[model samples]
Target: MVMVMVVMGETATPAHAEPAAAGSLEADGNDEVLTSKFTYYSGRTLADPSKTMIFSGNGNVPLAEDIAKYLGVSLGNMNVSSFADGECSIKVNENIRGKHVILVQSTCPPSVNDSLMELLLMISTMRRSSAKTITVVMPYCGYARSDMKRGRERSPIAARDIMTMIETMGADRLVCVDMHSGQMQGFLSPAVPSDNITAIKVGALYFAEKMVNVPDSASEDAPRRNVVVVAPDEKAVSRAKEFWNVLIEKGVPEARFAMVLRKPNLEEQERKEQPQSAAAVSATSVDTDPSTALEHEIVGDEEAIADCDAIIVQDIIDSGQSMSNAASALKAGGARNVYGFATHGLFSRDALERIDRAPLDHVVVSNTASHPIGYEDKPTDKITWISIAPLLAEVLRIISEKESLNPVFRLPKEQQ
Candidate 1:
């Protein structure tokens, strides 16, 4: 009895209940039970499965262990050590010849080099071992923002170069989470399927839970909070709408709706102008879908949030630059309480401190990008962590089953 692992797609089916997972695939006249064993640990990558073998890797052994546990698979072991000259050695103890492999690695700050090199080597090792397919799941996608950076001396196509490198490493597929800009996907040669999953659903659920006070719970000291879904800039308008959708689902009436719009991405901003010269390069379409590259512009109804409850800010990071600025404007505009939610908490360069000083009551983020241990130094008064693993797990199931992903996308809104 062999269990089948499936990667899910946008049209994947929903997992209604957690089946009593069988270690080995066994069928009792039920096709669902036939594949009873869990196959995916879940993050945000939406892919489909075709009864394939999925081997997980992320450079670090612990994270790989976590993924294995969630997938209900025997954890694959690895041996990695350094030499006196600071070089690294690697050994994967899995016989993965012709196996469909998934190497999970989030290139966070210090671990970027190690993770990249290890993942590359692991893929190469698997390739040499004759694995059938390789998919690299880089959760944070560190250099993603660099794809659209405005600089002259540096390469105008750094992000695309990274995409090229990943493909050259023998990856059959690539999946990254909410990129700084969706257009970053344009660099690839389309040899593989690259999916960008949104953390908005995760962010929505976080805000819905933390901000418990509604009109009924509003006291004199704590009047019904005004929940405004604010996007720091135009890029976040879609994410803000996601937050707004959650607010509506959480029993908030239609009147309590509003979103802060940001300036659109002008063609000039997307241009790569050579310093001291008039040469400018137009930004290429970053997504397989041509329509996605267009700038985001959300124009909510005028009565949106006319009698609001609270503001739910949705984003991937605060960085104190965008979220802080939006908080300032919301405070000045007389927002009752400014609460926020992001997927990845990359609080670099005193971002947490600046958020602490801002007019915010709470900020929710998921542990999908970085672990919660690092945020202990940040002010705890307004910070909260939501475990998105469950949601991610469900999404993984749907993708593997070839079912629709819309149901899971709607679940976070239901939590509201």
Candidate 2:
């Protein structure tokens, strides 16, 4: 093969990492100030000397341009169109033989069709052209939720199938934002440089800023005190640890770190014996009943929720039925302020509307998953969005410099 990725726009050179203490991964003492990562390096988009191919999907055009502007390389030649026969058509306006071709696309909504078709065609075209290296940057990766097969006689794992498709199509490397699970990369070919990047630091900084504004919001006695990070489900415990580490680096005392043990929701017997429906219809309003609160019914542990004043929630996915149920439990238990922090905000089936109805004080999801349409603004709703552009741009810069990604998190946001 060949290396032909959808093009990521070329941008300016990355900065050098200053020297640090010895024997520390902190600093490798490697100082080589560089400009751009491309083998045919230059600053202007239309002026690069190398035959690099930079192509962008309609959704990812802006990001591709940002990355291109960051790498200081000229854009490659590409023309995408729809034929009269209702088939997507593409023409390579430039030669890419033995050249590194980069392709950029966002696998967001309409993911199955637009993302799949666009990426496949782009890769197949570059592969046929014998490009040297092909890298793909999917900022909002779709089909990621299908990372695992929960039921049946073992059909294809969606994530594996997708990676295989890309690999078979001629992708030498892969880059995507917060995957459903980071370990999913292991299923792909080892030769493929698959980087599953995250932006916990960005979230941590946002949390820090929020803490500074309200000193005693999440904690009382120690206003500057750190709060526990919680994973709503057992599957997300790993992310909770990663988020805790980032908080530590951001100045949260280690003693404050804790993971809420994820327990199963009430099963059939527990609900039947508890007089669940009776409580909803009697003694309280309709809103108090878990079954009537959202479209789906739920019963959570109020003890677990009320114990914590503030919680750093890991995710809000899977119809948000669980989150809403859990939120009700928290309100009953004792949590004063409940805040959710997730890399992806996949609010499905009227989830945003229901979340607004919950007692939660704040919910923050990155700009990674398109902000859930109208979630940016709503009456009686508090939702904040953080950008992962800096984090992703940093990864590209480090890859170009042949540097380790350890420093990527430490680099200041302004530099990223």
Candidate 3:
């Protein structure tokens, strides 16, 4: 729990020993001159500039910039450009020889190909330039959904392909926020070390603060307290459980858990009888196929949803179709308020519009994916953007110090 602060040319210990307070100004400046200090913890006894050089790819400059500021190091000078016919040019402008090179990039939306290519070029260039270690800090791992073959489709596993490219290009380690599947780790082993940090812990803490209003009669044994955690799909059940555990640890009243079960052709049957936008048709197209259906049912005690607050937990909200359906279903079931916690806000296409029209109160998402999809300046009440920047900065510090990332990778025993 040793917290270090990165001020200009000096190391100061944070009074509160909190890593998130890095770069926060202390209240010591008098009226004569206002002075502020930036604090950063390197997880080290001695600070050395040559030890680490962080670089920001074009995909996520803002996040990379925040990480750099947190680490008290400037982003390594690198020039990335495109040719007339859409070719990529990369130049490592700074000498990064013998430094632990950390590159931050997220392959998400609009131009996944370009983003991936830029990251690959950066890794290749840095490796050839003799960097000691190359770590790819990808908060949102694109193409991760294709980790395994689905229904004998003769398609290259895109997740494996991306990992292979990185391994072939000489990456020492890969740090991603959340892979679509935890099993994707098997693909990176023995060649490149990979860490998939889940944002559930981050989301749980956030919701605990906003979702603290509980019924007075609520008890640990009862555990339903007018709030219900909804798992949008089977894949998200584990994440929902994790979120609930963290919420309870954060002192929110005990909550109930439920899930959305995929009921077969009910929607198809409805479509034939009376077609009406197929249930809850969303205009958003994060990963559009234009053919996916939205038909799900609540699988717990039906009475639990009535007059209760519902928080839908999901990993990634791609088209937002499932989310829209879940919100509509919960509201139709008489749920009072519907909130959402999605780890990756791939708020593609017109997701904002869909979310606005849906019966959801607010959807909290992590900045695992970069801009255009996250932290928009335009005012919106349905979405709340949370930053994993502190979490990323903390992980980078642990990596730089050659320490275990388990502390950040998992919730503490108490929280868990």
Candidate 4:
């Protein structure tokens, strides 16, 4: 939907009134930065001309628009609404028959269930309309936290359940951002084409330009450098390594890397010690402890974290517990600056509050998940939001060309 806002006529027009030309940045004598166009195409014609269509689901339309802009395309017309009984309804205004359709949606807060249901319905509609292929571009997978099952739990793995529903609803392919677990990628059935694109490169570029203070002549094994990449826990080693690799590509050779190990917090241990009947345990009582549920220990390169800037890298920051613990531990280990990067910032209840009390200088997250209202209004808070649209657009453009996504990761030439 195009924005229609009332503006006073005769207001002074800015120098950037005209759109910038594609693939260039202009500056009006150091006064303002004007971008002619933000795009990700590689000058390749579509394999099937006019056969590619992009649609926006109910959630996060602004992000979808950004992606469309990156592709130099407009969003396909679609009317999405609800019935009186809370049932989802949709009407496609453009012809998508026999077309390669990409539906952009992020199952984030406010109404995850409704957003997911609408996405499923849209896929089914497109499939019934003879769409050649339907790809669901979900930046934030809603049930990702429940990717694994607990001991003796009777319920199905929610992440798998969501994937099964999408595949069964006639979706031909799926594209998602940083998921909860890499193992979740294996759960996809053999027929469905899936890709778990990440924003680590995006975050690394930001840190390299704005945060890195490394020297150019440093060696690759400079483990005791000024800036260090940290994995909040063992589970995040791979993510931290990816960020480190991108930083290296961006010319931060002195940047080092480390990983943290977590031990259960005192409060969590106490709760575990208390005996409870099966009925009480089944009630899912909430733990009210304000402290992090875990304590961090530097498991790799302890010397690298001593008296240096530390950047914690992780895929998801749900409760911010592990982040909080890692920040405290890094500070206690004599780290001068503590920053964090999480691809998806779920920031569930009191997560911001917890981060406020932690020793972190800034927690940078991508716009894969929506920010809560007033998140930036706090007097002493540091939460930065980055856009993952360009990365998504690049991947989508590659997929549309029937090309492999291996180049996005800077893989070896033979692999590509």
Candidate 5:
């Protein structure tokens, strides 16, 4: 049995004996007392603010700062530099002995490898320095897409390898946002608890606010502005359905669901099964551009999408080819205004320009990953960024309090 007392204000200390260490297990045959200045009654031992430290790597510093600010704490002092030969050098400038440490790092583009290495090194440093526990807050988990081997090729399961590395480096837990595949959690060892949270609710709330004031297109008794949530591919159908349900719950009266069916590229499929011979080499001569290789057609309740506003929901928007193609398909299927929403916006290699020229009216993505270079100079209103700091902070707080996280998976009461 355990008892946690939350004292308010600067009052006199209770008559109870000195509380045990933050993470120490006391077995004196009496109820354990876990009290602190910033403690609260959350049915578990909540993290004391003074003893909780937050650190960040080179990836997404702004996000880390926002999370710290939300939690009413300052970030820990940590210096990360590179050696003469490009080796990572990390130094934690604060004493984290027996303290709960949270490290914020996203393995994103422009420095994926470096960011990962820095995180691993930081975890090892904290473990060796006698930290009570280390929690890795990785908003964008790189290499998540390489989850499985393709066909019969002997390919490395990079996602599993990365998870193994993090766990081996002594991370107690991991928290990531919108992993490409939910199965990636299985890649981690059971010792390292992993949380794969979603930013779909955040995205849904943003769209709900934008569509709240939209007047009814028909009579007062008729449905409100016709809106359809679209899944760009078969894998995204579940996500799109979740987004659609949230929109309706948020008062989007006429929200509907649709999906873009992709035609299999027979030629490409045949080439993959062929051997690495001259014939296979010549077969690759065909245009392999994703945007033009395969065809897409919108399939769903036709009445729900005809002349209705379409919003494409996806996990990651890398290169913008699939998004552009999905938007074009929706427009061709009688969608008036096509929008795109994704959790991670990895706009690489002219993706922004391609989106600007595409049929999409607007695109919204969470700030899980930092924007690439030249993103600000791009002259287009098609891109919007929303922050996931509040959600992440809430999750961190729940974890610190050792409470059930089922609440975070649902839409907030206010939004509902």
Candidate 6:
């Protein structure tokens, strides 16, 4: 069998050629080349890097590069542009005939529709180009919060709609990071297998290291620190519990889990009940503004949380209201310090500023979605970013090797 590896910008490297070192190729504009060869290939049972090709949409190029580097392959050449009318146009610069294609894109805020369109176009183009298989790596699946019907309105399940579009467009598999609801996987076609991975373990390991130096109770021989994992809402209780479990396994002692209940906002409900004139209703208010829609109330064992450090865990942090409210409530309940961890940080509106002013001492988020340009230069001392590229790269490798992905659901030994 002949090996074929498509390198960005440069010509395809032959199988016998020596692999280039990772990060040796600088990404130059849209025509950058990033190529590397797999040094060891035992047999067909392992992933044939030559047959695999990875591409990135306009949404998150940096993350795609990181994953490609990890797999010892270059990102496939692709160009995504927009027409005068704002329609997306995708051009695959490489020949992907009979090759397994992986596309990395996150349907996130600010331009969710555009990002999603780019993904669909890429998938359709790959299918038309005779690609052997297509796997969509969407780090942040947009409209995931619309997994279920709400109220009595005849609303569409947008998540399901997006899934149908993807399946119809010819994607063979789907992968997401910390999907807002696990049930969303059922929305996809049965033939299209989906994996909803979590970043809770990643967040847990980060906190474990920070809290490792805390003192243990005098009565116990082993060192232990009192810590409480707080869920921002009832829906996030499972996430908080998962984080707590990992913390325990990572040698964090005396960990407890709690949930913050959202109190109904009577004022917001009344406003919704009142008929609104089309002229009065702004486009932004089409969805309920989370910042003013609910109040938070902490509920858990008082002795467990009082005077203990608190870590609020959730899937997404949009607007930062829920996180701020939970942290404020925890402090009022006598919690000594408060921290927050969210898988996706969609800092919409004034979220970053709100988080900076909130009572949370520190916050950690996974780099599932790309931040705005120039955000890196900002002095956001309370926020830290952790990359999920390694986890995603391993998943891609496993899929290419045709291995069961059950092991990836749990925290790795090193992380624990």
lDDT of 3 by residue, 150-264 (tens): 7656788989888888889999999998778888888886878788888887777656544533333446454434878899888889989988887777676557889887677
Q: Which candidate number maximizes TM-score?
A: 6
TM, every model: 0.68, 0.70, 0.80, 0.79, 0.82, 0.83
lDDT top scorer = 5
Tens-place lDDT digits, model 2, residues 206-288: 56444422344435554453255666656666776676665666566531433333344476437545545665634332233
Off by over 4 Å in 1: 1-66, 82-88, 149-154, 209-213, 216-225, 255-314, 372-381, 398-416
Candidate with better lDDT, 1 vs 5: 5
Off by over 4 Å in 6: 1-46, 212-223, 276-295, 377-379
- Which segments of model 4 are wrong by more than 4 Å? 1-49, 213-225, 264-294, 376-381, 411-416
Model 5 stretches with alpha carbons more than 4 Å out:
1-47, 216-223, 270-294
lDDT of 1 by residue, 60-150 (tens): 3333334433444444445555556656556766577766666766766445676566667767777787878776766667666667546
Q: How many backbone clashes does candidate 2 have?
A: 30
Which structure is stronger by lDDT: 2 or 3? 3
Given candidate 6, what's the lDDT at residue 314? 93
Better of 2 and 4 by lDDT: 4
lDDT of 4 by residue, 1-416 (tens): 22221111121212222322221122212211211222232433335447788887767776776676666666788888777678788788778888889888888876789889988998988998899999899999998888877876667789988998999989888898888887777778989988988778767766765557333235745443477899888888888999998777666787888877877568867876688787776443323333442355787677877888889999888777788878888888889889998888878766777778788887778888766545646523377666666668778888887788887665332210
Better of 1 and 4 by lDDT: 4
TM-score of 6: 0.83
Candidates ranked by lDDT = 5, 6, 4, 3, 2, 1
State the C-alpha lDDT per candidate. 0.53, 0.58, 0.71, 0.72, 0.77, 0.76
- Candidate 4: residue 361 lDDT (0-100): 83
**Which portions of model 2 show Cα errors greater than 4 Å?**
1-53, 72-77, 81-86, 94-98, 151-154, 212-214, 217-222, 254-309, 315-318, 371-381, 409-416
Estimate candidate 4's alpha-carbon lDDT, on a 0 to 1 scale. 0.72
